[model samples]
Target: MISALNRLVDLVEDHLVEEVDVDGLAKALGTTEYHLRRMFSSLAGMPLSEYVRRRRMTLAAADVVRGGDDLLGIAVRHGYGSAEAFGRAFRAVHGAGPGDVRRDGGPLLAQPRLRFRLTVEGSTPMRTRLVDRPAFRLVGHAARVPLVHRGVNPHIQRHIAGLPPEEHVRLKALGDAEPAGLLQVCDDVDPDAREGSELTYLHGVAVSGDTPTPGDLDAIEAPEGTWAVFRTDGPYPDALQSTWAATATEWFPSNPWRLRPGPSVVAVLDRADDFGTATCELWLPVEPA
Candidate 1:
């Protein structure tokens, strides 16, 4: 996985002035674009597209400082059709427009080319299990929410809090399959998993395939697949969030499994009365790599 990411970075560098063929590169590397992008965003702490933009602007700054070609020529050379488009990208990265930088030879924010490396840190083993689940239904109240990488997402908190207490009980009672509890589900997520990207957040539970979903609830068809389930216990959200980050940094690199397209489900097995701590089972769809 580390080698594949490094190759992806190299591919980006080679094609900075053209569209990146992520799908083709992923296929050549025996991986999916979805998994590759997700892993890149997770481990690199930024989306692949964001990295590309930063890298492009970093180089463009040089041309802006060294005067010879007009802004349009420099923009065209860097793949932007017009100076306006290039200026937007340039200002986004360097916090100064191309014209301003050219006039002053001033501030520049450089995003160095990325290189991925694997570090040995398996001292604490993750508690995990593999489950082959048949087609099932996730039924519940769902809303579009922005993705949050760390800490408790207040949007999700507000969603659940808005539900009547009895709704929670009702959802729990309706859960008749594995991941047997009120589940926190994220579906239709962006491949890059970019922070603040909108995703379908379903506060729901798992039900058998044959079960009929209540008309009042939203239903997501979960296709049959193998799942990698990780167990975590500690402070509310913090511990669960840490385990999620480690999955990309440690587990996936070490395991033979890779992520597949599906909603990630979190089932809370236990929790404190004040909701300060929890024992959670995070279920992620996967396939043999």
Candidate 2:
């Protein structure tokens, strides 16, 4: 994975003036574009598209300063058709227009090339299992919520709170599958997994496909697939969120599987009255790498 990501970085640098085909590059590296973009965003601390733009602008600023060509020509060479389009991109990255930078030679934000490396550590282990689940319905009060990477997501909390208390009881009773409780489900997530992206957040439960859903409740039809389940016990949401991050950082890199598009389900095994601490089982859909 590290080698592939480094090669991808090299490819980006080699084709800064050209339209790099990410899907083809990912295919050449023996990975999917979805996984590649997701991993790049996770490790690079920015979206792949954003990195590409910044890298292009970083180099374009040099030509603007050197005075070899006009702003329109430089912008067109960098894949922008017009000076207006290129100026917007240039100002976004360098905080100054190309014309101003051409005269003043000031204000440049450079995004350095990315490199990925691995460090072997045998200190901790991840608890995981492979589950082949049949098709099940996720039934509950659903909401559109922005994605949050760490700590608690207050939007999810408020969404669940807005549901009638009895609805929670009803959802729990409906669950008869592997994740046997009121499940916290996130579906139709953006492949890049960008923070603040809106995702289908279902405070729901898994049920058999034949199970009937109430018209008032939102439902997500989850198809049968292989799942990677991780179990954790600690402070509510904090430990769970850490485990989630570790899957991309530690677990997936070392494993022979890659994430697939599906609803991520979290089943609460136990929790305190105030929801400060608990045990949780996180189910993520995946396939052979």
Candidate 3:
């Protein structure tokens, strides 16, 4: 994975003036674009697309400062068709317009090329189970919410709170499959997992695919797949969130499994009345790498 990401970085640099085909590159490297983008964002601290833009503007800044060509010529050379569009991108990346930089030879924000490397450390073993789940459907009240990596997501809390108390009980009764209780489900998530990205949040439960859903509820069709389930128990959200980050930073790097595209499910086996702590099972869809 480290080597693959480095090659992706190199590819970006090689084609700063043209569109880079990330899908083809990922396929050739024996990985899906979704997984590759997710891994890149996780380890590189930015989305692959964002990184490319920053690099492009970083290089374009040189030409702007050198005054070797007109703004239009420089813009076209860097794959932008017009000075207006290029200037917007430049300011987005460097906080200054190309024309301003050209006149002042001013400050520039440079995004250095990224390199991923592995360090040997396996001090603690991850508690996990591999399961082959048949097709299922998640049904519940769903909302579009922003991705939050730390602490409790107040939006999620609000979504749940808005549901009538009887609705929670009704949803629980409707569940009839593994993850056999009300579940916290996030689907259609951006592979980059960018903070503030919108995702489908289903405060719901799992049922066999053939099960009929209530007309009033939102439903997500989950195809059959292999799942890697990680179990954790500690402070509410903190421990669960850490385990999620660790899967990218520690578990996936060391294991033969790679994440596949699917909705991630969180099942709370136990918790406090105040929700200050929890015992959670996080289910991530995966396949052998």
Candidate 4:
């Protein structure tokens, strides 16, 4: 996995002036584009697209400073059709437009080339299990929420808090399958997993496919697949969030499984009365790599 990610970085560098054929590169590397992009985003802390833009602008800055080519020519070479488009990308990355930088030869933010490496750090073992589930249904109140990488997501908190206490009991009672509790379901997520991207957040329960979904709830069909379940316990969401990060940085790289498209489910097995701590089971869909 580390080698594959390095190869992806190399591919990006070799095609900074052109469109990256991520799908083809992923196929050649024996992985899917979705898994590749997701892993890259998780480990690199930025989306693949964002990295490409920064790298492109990093090089484009040099040309602007050198004054060897007009802004339009440099923009065209960097895959932008017009100067305006290139200016937007440049300003986004460098915090200064091309024209301003060319005139003053001033501030420039350079994005260093990325290289992925693996380190040996397995002191604490992760408690995990693999489950093969048949088709199931996730039914509950659903909302579109922006993705937040770290800390508590107030939007999700507000969503859940808005519900009456009985609704939580009702959702738990509705669950009749594995991941057997009120589940935090994040579906239709962007493969890049970019921050601020909207995703379908379902505060619901899992039920067998044959089960009838209540008309009042939204339903998401979960196709038959295998899940990599990690059990976590500690401070509220911190432990759960760390386990999620570890799955990308440690588990996937070491295991033979790759992530597949599906909703990520979080089942809170136990928690403190004040909700300050929890024991959670995080289920992520995967397939043999």
Using Cα atoms with residue i matched to residue i, what is each candidate's TM-score against the true structure?
0.99, 0.93, 0.96, 0.98
Clashes of each: 0, 0, 0, 0
lDDT of each: 0.94, 0.87, 0.91, 0.94
The reply for model 4, stretches above 4 Å from the true place, is: none
In angstroms, the error of model 4 at 54 is 0.2
| lDDT per residue as tens, model 2, 12-83 | 999987877888988887788888888888877788888899999998988999998988998988989899
Name the lDDT value of residue 147 in candidate 4: 95
* Order of models, best TM-score first: 1, 4, 3, 2
Model 3 Cα lDDT, one tens digit per residue, 1-289: 8778888989999998888888999889888888888988888778888998999998899999999799999999999999999999999998989888988897799888777889876577789999999999999999999999898999999999999999999999999999878899999999888899999999999999889999999998888999999999999899999889888888887888888999999999999998899999999999888
Q: How high is the lDDT of residue 261 in model 3?
A: 92
Better of 1 and 2 by TM-score: 1
TM-score of 2: 0.93
Lowest-lDDT window of 10 residues in candidate 3? 117-126
Give residue 7's error in model 4 in angstroms. Answer: 1.0
- For residues 22-126, could you state the per-residue lDDT of candidate 4 as single tens digits? 999999999999999999999999999999999999999999999989999999988999999999999999889999999999689999999999999768999
Every model: Cα RMSD to truth: 0.8, 1.7, 1.4, 0.9
